[model samples]
Target: MSLKSFGAKIFAKNIRKKIDKWASKPEATQKKVFQELIDKAKDTKFGKDHDFKNIKSYADFSKKVPVRDYEELRFYVDKMVAGEEDVLWPGKPLYYAKTSGTTSGAKYIPLTKDSMPSHINAARNAILCYIAETGNAKFVDGKMIFLQGSPEMEEKNGVKLGRLSGIVAHYVPSYLQKNRMPSWETNCIDDWETKVDAIVEETRNENMSVISGIPSWVQMYFEKLQQKTGKKVGELFPNFDLFIYGGVNYEPYRSKFENLIGRKVDSIELYPASEGFFAFQDKQTEKGMLLQLDSGMFYEFIKADEFFDENPKRLTVGEVEMGVNYVMLVSSNAGLWAYNIGDTVQFTSTNPYRVMVSGRIKHFISAFGEHVIAKEVEEAMQEATAATKARISEFTVAPQITPKNEELPYHEWFIEFEKEPEDLAKFSKTLDESLQKQNSYYFDLIEGKILQPLKISRVPENGFQQYMKSIGKLGGQNKLPRLANDRKIAEVLEKIIKA
Candidate 1:
């Protein structure tokens, strides 16, 4: 390495040392420090008329503005594209993080200079907390890998919006940024599948010490890595010590990961989105992740039981009760106020503020007009698998609308099993019973003659993962979208759904 690169490493080490000191404090202390940081945000305003001074506390601040969504930001983004100043926040939006929504295509999320720090700091906290947990502050010294979209998201106008991963790299303290495989400048907007393959090839020979990305894509990339490198990932990237992931459920994916790497990865869960990074793994044993409430944002949780047109309820951070699900609404420095991110989560405990992300509200299957959620499916599948002695690696459920000739609509599951069962039909029946038992709505729909039996397709061991790879759409921020609820998704499912 060059002298500059070597010097950068030393600088990174010192920075990490400082972060370690900050994170070594008790969780309660960190929360207080973060709250103070948030208080400063309230005091910082753009114009003389900016009304934040009237807001005395987090509860008062949240009540002043109704919860918002991605659509609200899109309106501001439109203004930014039209050359409007201070459109997204109080200042110019310095970066637009392009991310896909459930529908209406890609949303160009505006990130002002003020808001980016929240994301950067939250990520810093994640790293430092991990170090504190493991007692290893020099974690970044090893080679790192991130399975991300191609750094080439050049738009039709020739202006390049850096890939989400590239933007992170650019903002990282220069000393800590890893020596990435493909130069970010060369292929910023390359398709997701292309990025996955390129990342696999780029890291084929290198010894990666840390790996990070969405679980679905990471699973795909590892599968491809094994195929192309002709060696298991444990052999190729022998030094890999940590695997950080978020943006998807790890339960459907955990086993496949263990088999590929030949060991249990030191997994860390993170909540990162185009808007901001929200939370991270809190404790080694619990299912909860801690939120960065004090990092440039104010947070609220909507109670799952509360309703406005039957929608979930919103609760302020202070009002949160342990073990109840709530939707997240955020007010960020990026100019978004009371934005509902559409994710559902529950606090496992509140003393240290531990939470578990349940799933997306709109991303569930209820084809027979019976509301069935992803978590319900996961639970039923787990119970059925345990009872029938079948192991499922990964699975997705699609609602198959009836053809013009068909009489009814039904649910189809694309499942990859650990081992082919001797009696697939019996296994299917057991799973159906499990689903009925756990999800009464699903059971009612199935038994009362609203829907038919759930169809099962035994997918080729890695078929879905490969399909995502073949299409150049796997890894990092991109994932295997569950609950293909629309017609476009239906058509895609038609081709993939087995008889």
Candidate 2:
């Protein structure tokens, strides 16, 4: 083994011990984190506003501070952006993660020095844990590339601001910097298409062992590499083995990726957001990512069905149940207290608190009150593809409340198929049946004839790409929404619809 590989094993051993200690006593670890955050931020503007000094327990904190989304918390965030001292956290934020917001224009999530380690360590430890468990560390010596946002940043109120991925680019550890691929100039290319082409040229002849990025963008890179050199990804980089990804579930894209690589590769899933780095896949054999108990974040979950109730019960980690969809609220070291990040998740394992991102709370189809979430639609697509032996490049779901033909209103699936199914009708039926099985409201609507079985609209090849590019989002750190409540995405899709 190379020296770095050998050192990684030793480092992983130490990190695993810490992981085990916290995982074994998750509730206790969380309680400690909660206490420490309350104590440290007691004198900050937000702490004073919420009476943090007198807060003794979760109940006390909950009573003092109601759940707030980015919009509600922007009042305090604006003060911080104005260069006020200690407006939220103990001191000024180290940086701001500027993310897109629909109703609120743009959101600036604070990243304090205290919270920075959570993002960095979680990413590092995920790799280390893989090394420790699998005893395969050769990838450490070979090139690894994370297709990410540009590292270029701008200044906002004395604080550096950029996309979360871009901000994180500045923090890559010195040890692995030597093995990281795509030259600095290539990464700084603002146009994603140009960047990917540059990256293809830069890394096409190098030794690539690990590739990480959002799956869709990575797929584009893989296709470009194949075009540049007529070889499978695995053949191009025989040592390539590990694939790390976050932002979206990788299952739907797995078949296509495996085909492009010409083999299967071990993958590590991560659940991270601008608000926090919440979880990472610890075991290769496991179904979900393990929550970071000691990440200085206190988690609260409200049942998705009851989330909008006047006073929904906010359950701590100890009270969350396995397999139930919950809207996650977080109080973190970053000064976001009882903050709703808008993602819904389901706990797959309660022992060590493993979770899967089910969907976004607002990214659902409820135009007819069926309320189909992203998870449901994605799974439905999975089932349909499996049954029909169909391959898809991309897809999205939106409710068609008004039909031009005056037919029954129905869900419209805008899909770009990589390989067309022999029997498209059977594929559509399978998609509807799978969705009906998962959501009773949807099943009832179908049975009662309030909604027709979903209609499939073929999107021309590269149509989704064209749509994204048209919206000026054909680049790093952007994700396509799985489902939308209205026809906003569907109408635009119609212009490019093939059949």
Candidate 3:
């Protein structure tokens, strides 16, 4: 084995031992983290405002600090942006993660000194965990590439500001610094198309052992490489054996990726966000990512269904149950107190606290009270894809309240197929059946003839690409939702559907 590979294995063994220690006592570890956060921030402005010193338990904390989303917490964030010290955390934030928000044009999520390592270390450990489990560290010796935003940052009140991924780019671990690729100049290119072209030229003839990014953007990179050389990614980079991905679920794009690579690669799933690095897939055979219990962030969960309802029951690490959908809440060392992070999750393994991100709390369809979620639609499509041997490029769903034929309102699906199925009718039928099995309210609505069976609108090849380009989010970590509550995306897709 090469020296790099041997070192990776040794490093991985030590990290795995540490992960196992905390993962085994999740509740206790989380409790410790919770107390540490409270103790550390007790003297900050937010703590003083929330009566943190008087807070003794979860009940006291909840009563003092109400959960707030970005918009709701913008008042305090605005103060920090203007260079306030000891306002939220102990001191000024180290970085501001610039992300596009729902109503607010741009959101600046604070990343403090203590909280930044949670992001860096969790990502590093994920690879280490993979290396330890598979006993394959050869990938560490070859070129590894992550398709991410430019590392360029602008300063606001002496705090560096950029996209979360871009900020993360500045912190590439020392060991893998030599192995990481696509050069600084190419990565700094602002326009994604130009940058990707540069990447293809630079790495086409090189050994690319590991590729990591959001699936959609990575697919674009894969396509660009294939177009240039007319060879599958696996053929071009035979040493490519590992794929690390985050931002969106990969199951929907698994078939397309497999076709592009012409084979399977061991993969790791990560659940990282600007709020905190929450989880990472530690075992190749596991169903979910292992929750980071000792990471300087305390977690709270409320049932997604009860989220809109007043006084919803909140559960801590020990109270969460398996397979129940919960809207995640975080109180972290970054000084966010009982903050709503928007994503919903379902615990797959409660013993060690492994979870699957189910959907976004805001991105749901309850138009007719059917209350459908992204997980339901994605899984339904997965089932249909498997049953019909279809290769889906991309897809999204929205409720069609006014049918063209003036028929009963129903859910309309827009699907882009890499390879069209032999039987579109059978595919649609299977999709409806799978959705019905998963959502009782949707099933009831269809059974009572209140809503029609879901319809599929075929999007021509590269339709999603055109749509994203029009929206100025063609590449990078941007991801279109799997489902939406209304027809906004559908309306836009309608005009941009490939002719």
Error of 2 at 479 (Å): 0.4
In angstroms, how far off is 416's CA in candidate 1? 4.1
Model 3, 81-161: lDDT tens digits are 999998889999999999888798899999999999999999999999998999998888899999998889999988999
Task: Write the candidate numbers in order of decreasing TM-score.
Answer: 3, 2, 1
Clashes of each: 16, 0, 0
Which has the better lDDT: candidate 1, or candidate 2?
2
- Structural similarity to truth (TM-score) of each candidate: 0.80, 0.98, 0.99
Which stretch of 10 consecutive residues in model 2 shows the poorest summed lDDT?
Answer: 490-499
Provide the RMSD of all predictions against the true structure, rounded to 1 decimal. Answer: 5.1, 1.2, 0.9
What does candidate 2's lDDT look like per residue over 1-499, in tens digits?
Answer: 8998999999998998889889999999999999999999999999999999999998899899999999999999999999998878988999999998989998999999999999999999999889989999999999999999888899987999998988898999998788887878888899889999999999989999999999889989998999899999999999999999999988888878888899999999988789999999998988899999899899999999999899999999999999899999999999999999999999999988999999999999999888899889999989888888888888999888878878999999999888887789999999999999999999999999999999998999888888899888996979899999978888888887733
Q: Pick the candidate with the highest TM-score.
A: 3
lDDT of each: 0.66, 0.92, 0.91
Ten-residue region with minimum lDDT total, candidate 3 = 490-499
Model 2, residue 100: C-alpha shift (Å): 1.3
Indicate the TM-score of model 2: 0.98
